[model samples]
Structures are given as structure tokens and as C-alpha cells.
Target: MKRILLAALGAISLSACAQAPGGGQAPGATASAPVAKPTVAAAQAKAGTPDARAIEAVRVLNPKVKVERVGAAPMPGFREAIVAGQVVYVSDDGRYLFLPGSGGALFDVQAQKNLSEDAMNVVRKQLLQTIPRSERIVFAPTNPKYTVSVFTDVECGYCRKLHSDIAEYNRQGIAIEYLAFPRMGIGSDDYKKMVAVWCAPDRRKALTDAKNGRGPTNASCKTSVNQQYDVGRRAGLTGTPMILTAEGVEVGGYLPPAALRQALDKLAAEQAPVATAKPGA
Candidate 1:
């Protein structure tokens, strides 16, 4: 099961990388800034706790890189730090930093579980929730059995294909909440088009038209396109049609309606609460 899961995720990641235009950075690319390093005294003051120490270790490597959050990792003697939306582990004593591929991932051999990916899933879930449903362009069924958030680009081919099948997905009881993620960056034509779509009187129709190559009508409004793009970036989106489960798990890239429904059903089953019987019964 672990191997199958990893293979599926790997294929999806590759697909996303290939679909992204303008050679956008990989998922979880570090967002660097021209920030100055903390003084020794300041670092010392904040290094009393394990979280601070872990954060300090990452800062010591490159002050320009942002360290968003730090917490205890599932691995013993290490702390998980969310640096620029990527998960990196630092030694509890602030000596070592374990990047995903560099030093290998944290896995539970006994349980066949990838702890590192689990941590990242939590981060994705939290970051995704920060954008409320009101801010998104939603295409949902009257009664949805599953709702998936998608980071989408207006001009991406795969994204358009997914949108074309939007009705099929809705028929399959899958609600799709679309968030703008213009691969060409903010202020680009793609961004403008998405803004137009979001600003349209009927976003669902406007989005469908745009996806079908009708082009968005000329209009402007105070839309959340920029904010949604930022959130997608922080959530490690590398391409359009980046589908994420309600629990923030990246099942894979574009899937046919039936395949998508199957995947969602499997996920639902896995996440369902297990029934426990009363001892006396």
C-alpha cells in the first residue's frame, strides 16, 4: 500500500511539474527575502525552547528563507519546521537539518507510514482552510458527498480539460471549489483573466466559458485572485488543476470522473470512524 501510494504521488508530482508554464519553481520552492540575520543575543534569547531552537537552526542556514512554524516531529530527537511551506526537520539540539530528499524522509518502517508526508498534509490542510469558501468559485451539487479544493490556472490545458468535465464530477457527487492560481504569476494575462472570471455576474458560467476558450469578458472587481494565488503558492502548488482532498491530502492530479469518485470513496472509507463493539454485547 505504501509503495502504491508513493508511486501514485510521484506520478502526480511529475505531471504537475510538466504542466506548469514559464518554468515555475517546484512545489514548496523556498520564498527568499532580503532579511538580515538575527543578532547572536537575539538568537540566544529565543533559543530557550525547542521550537525556537529548531527555527534558529534553519535561520542560521539562510536568514533570507522564511521559517513559518516549528513543532515537535514524529521522529525522536528532531523537530519539524515548516520553512517557506516545505517541511524540514531540525535536530532538537539545533545541530542538524534534514531536508526531504537530501537526508531521506522520516518513515515508520514498522507501520509503513511516511511521517514526513503526514506533517505536510497537516500544513496543507491548515493553509487551505485559511481561504474561506466564500472567496472561491464553487461548482457543487445540490448534495455533495465530497468537496475538493482545486488550485487552477485559466490557460492550462489540463485545467481546462478538468473544467470541461466539471458536470461529470458534480454528477459523481464531487464538489469542486476553484481557487485561482495563475501560473504566469500575479499581474499576468492569466491573472487578469481569472480576475475577470471571478468578477463576472455568474462565476460558474464565466469560468466554464473561459475554460472553453471563450476568454473572460472585460471586467474588474475587488476579487480574491491575488490572495488565492498567494495561498496556492504557500500550499506548494506547482501546476494548475492541483486537486486537494478535504483533509488536505494530495490524492493526485487530474482524474476522470469515475476514477476521481473511486479515489474519493476510498479516502472516505479510510477516514471513516471505525465501529467498536461494547464488551458486554
Candidate 2:
């Protein structure tokens, strides 16, 4: 039932300012000037509105799915909505729906940005915040410069590789917070293993041991593994070793310690507030 709904919301071709594939700005191209926002008249002219029909359409698709906010989509005829924690677009008449996942992305050619990715980043950051720091298995230096949350599966090779370099990451002032994302699904052996690791008296060591093939000791206790996995799903996670920066931008999977540090530095610079002269001083 859920699969059917997701399929109905399957990705649509990038619209609005985006051009056809291979027709827009070349890779590494940057816009010379900021894109102007739509004028009041232009905004009012857009076709779609988050009307009752659009909300009803989404509810019809997934009766139990939570319909959060419904607002203007970048595309002229569609309305963007947060449904069941994922972003989806519905047409003005409420007949069509689109998802920006499974290799499909909504892009802004002129801005050199993935609009869909931007929305997902916001969702990821918000969902991640719901899981308190105490619930995550954290490995960090005494004074870390940056912290990243990783959605990992114990049996994933690259996840193990990332853990193997955990020391180097710490040395580089990068803190890692581990969240369980068992690719094998809930109640599977892998999920049970992660639960055991989370239940261990020493979660950090248990996670490391599991990653290193030492295997998690059999145990059972109150754990947030299920909650973490649900959050990962809502965050649009499709694979393990999914690394997210503090601001919720996914840097990619399995970056080496040095490369990870460089990525973090770049992100920090991008997010840092720019300085302006005070009173022409």
C-alpha cells in the first residue's frame, strides 16, 4: 500500500528554471548574480495553491500519512507539501503528484542548485534534532571542531571502513555520531545486532566492535534503534554510511578522514556569516 503511494509520487522531470538534461550550465559554473525573487504579481499569478483539494489528494493516497505543511512549489503549476515527513509535489487540480527521489532531482539551472535536495536537507536537519545527543553513539575529541551524524549498517563494508578510520577523524577534530540504519530491515538479524550494540553498557565500544566484526554480545534493553531507523527513512536515506553535516547537507558516503575534514571546513565556511563594515569603518 505504501509502495503504491510512493510510486504514484514518483519523480517528475525537473521543471521551471531547469532545462533539459545536458542543456543547462556546465558543471562548476556559478551564477554571476543572485537570482531575483518572484514579484508580488508573479507570485499571485502562479497556478497552484495549497487548497483543500490538494490536501485531500495526499490524504487519499496514504490515509495514515501525516500531512504537514503545504505551500508553493518552485514549479508554477504544482504545490509543494511535506507528507509523511518527505517532500512531494501535487498539481493544482490535485490529480498529479511527484517525488524528488530515486535518482530524480529538481534543479535550478541558473542557481546551480538542486532544489529538491535543499528541501530534503531541511527535513533531515529537523528530524535529526528529534533524536537527542544522548541517544547517539558519539565518538569525539575532547574539543571537536565539527560533528557529523552517520546513518550506518554494521555489515556494510564502507561503514566498517569509516569506523576503521574513526581515530583519524577524531584527530582531525571531527566528531562522529552513529545512528542505526539496518539495511536488512527491522527484526532482521542485523537489526537485532544493532539493538544489542545499543543496549550494551558501553555503546561506543560495542558499536566499534560490531563494525570490526567482533559481533555484538547478545543482550536486550530499551533502545532507540527503531526510532533512529524510522528517522533515517523519513530523511530519505537509501543506503548505509550516509553522512550528514551538522546543517543536514549530505556530503556523501565513505569520505576519507582528510577528505571529510576538508568537506566540513568548506561547509563551515559556506555557512559562516559574512562580515560587513560597520558605518563604513
Candidate 3:
């Protein structure tokens, strides 16, 4: 799925990064034809790394693009900002914005790496790591093997169906860690109802009941519903039941129990670390 665009045109306007994360950088993974590095102001580049002014410049230029974090790009003289949850590089002076979103343009010559998709995967894994187990509404068997974090909406038909098969999933040793994602947006009825579910005294039962068409007894109390919704958005959740392997591989949609287990099995195998042969063996 890691493809180069621009001899790689046929470019779609939309940049949806999905699929297995990129492997080790490709051979000759180095910055291509060198261009002149922009002349950065001495005070700016040296002050606190990705200069505040540079971040402000990015914000000023792309007001709509949500700038999460900014730092030095793989290549010198370029500042990288995690804009709108995608990796983009801004020239040192902050005039040019380099995008890896356009397919293979992602390769960072100096780093011998793909900055776009590869960095996205890295970012995904990092963000996922920040989530503590206590924040998740988990359903697992006594003995668990694999775990997947799912963004769910109680009102979504597919979400409801997924929850209906929770037991089968548990039997297969797949733990379902649920996060609230009210697709109807924060103020709609779905959001309030889900908030109630999270606020309920018996969270596990409340989640099950809500998914099964029962209303949550209490919709009061501060809950992490809002924060979870934000996380879902950053994770590119377009719809309910957006499943992801523990490795941060996005499992597109609802897969029947068997298929889901099979998918997870393949994912686990893929993520399994290779054993280095013993010197004597």
C-alpha cells in the first residue's frame, strides 16, 4: 500500500492513509536531487527547535489545518508539523509546505525514509500508546490473547451487530476495547446517550445494554466521552465500529467473528518480532 505518487499522479484529491504500516525504508532511501536549503533566521531555528514563529507561520498559512505538533523534519532546513493528523513539512523560512500526502513524494532522501505514510504509522502508534488501559471500556475473557481498540457508536447498526458478537470475539481470545465515537457529532442525541453510558455506575453492563437498545440509566457525571470522540477523529474514524489491531492497523469495518479473528491472527503474525538466529545454531 506504500506507493509513490507524481510519476505517481493519477492522484486523488483525498489522502486516506490505510493498510499495513510501511516496512524498513526502501533501498536508496535517501533524499533525492538536492534543492537549496532555505535561509532560516539564526534566532528562530535555534530557539526551542521548531521555532514558535514557524509554527505560527504554518497556522497563519493553513488556518484550517489543525497543527498538533511541530519539529524538525528528517531533512535539515525543513520543519515538520503534524497538521490535521498528517505529516507535512514546511520550509525553514515557512514559505513552502512540502506534503508527503501525495503518495511517494513521502520519501525523505536524507533519512532514506518515507515521511508521509511511514510517519503516519509512527504517529499512530505513538498516539495509541498514550492511552491508558483504565480509559478504555474493555470486554475480555478470563484469559486473553489479542486485543483490538474499537471506536464505536451505540446507534450505529454495524456497531450494534459487532457488540452482539462480543462473546464470540472473547471466545476467540480477542479483547474488545471500546471507545465512544458519536458519529452524529457532540451535541446530537447519540452523544448525550453515549455520555450517559460512560457515566453509568456499571460501565460494562451499561455499554452492553446500550448496544442492545437499552438506554443508559444515568447520563450525568463527567465522562471521557468527549476526549474519546477527539481521539477517534484523530485516528481517522469515519464511521462506527472502526476496529484497529493493537499494532494500530486499521481494520476497515465490521468483520464477522471468524473473519475478525482471522484478520487479527494475520496481523499478530505480521507484527510478531522475527527471532534472530543464534550464532552457533
Name the lDDT of candidate 3: 0.71
Q: TM-score per candidate, in order?
A: 0.65, 0.64, 0.59
- Candidate 3 lDDT, 185-253, residue by residue in tens: 988888988989888778788888888888673467887888888877887666788887766677667
Q: Which residue pairs collide, candidate 1? A: none
Clashing pairs in model 2, backbone N/Cα/C closer than 3 A: none
Ranking by TM-score: 1, 2, 3
Residue pairs in collision within model 3: 4-104, 5-8, 5-104, 6-9, 29-112, 30-109, 31-109, 31-110, 196-219
What is the C-alpha lDDT profile of model 2 across 122-183, one tens digit per residue?
A: 99999999999999999999999999999999999999999999999999999999999999
Q: What's the residue-level lDDT of 92 in candidate 3?
A: 68
For candidate 3, the C-alpha RMSD (Å) to the true structure equals 15.1
Candidate scoring better on lDDT of 2 and 3: 2
The alpha-carbon lDDT assigned to residue 118 of candidate 3 equals 57
Question: Taking the tens digit of each residue's C-alpha lDDT, what string does model 1 give over 1-281?
Answer: 34432333233223333443667676888978865422222234354776787777656555666667666687789877666656677777776666664224554433445566678789889988888898888999999999999998879998988988889999999999999998999888888998999898888888888988896846778988888899888777766788998788887778888899999999889889999999999
Candidate 1: what lDDT?
0.76
Count clashing pairs, candidate 2.
0
Best by TM-score: 1
Q: Candidates 1 and 3: which is better by lDDT? A: 1
Give the residue spans of candidate 3 off by over 4 A.
Answer: 2-117
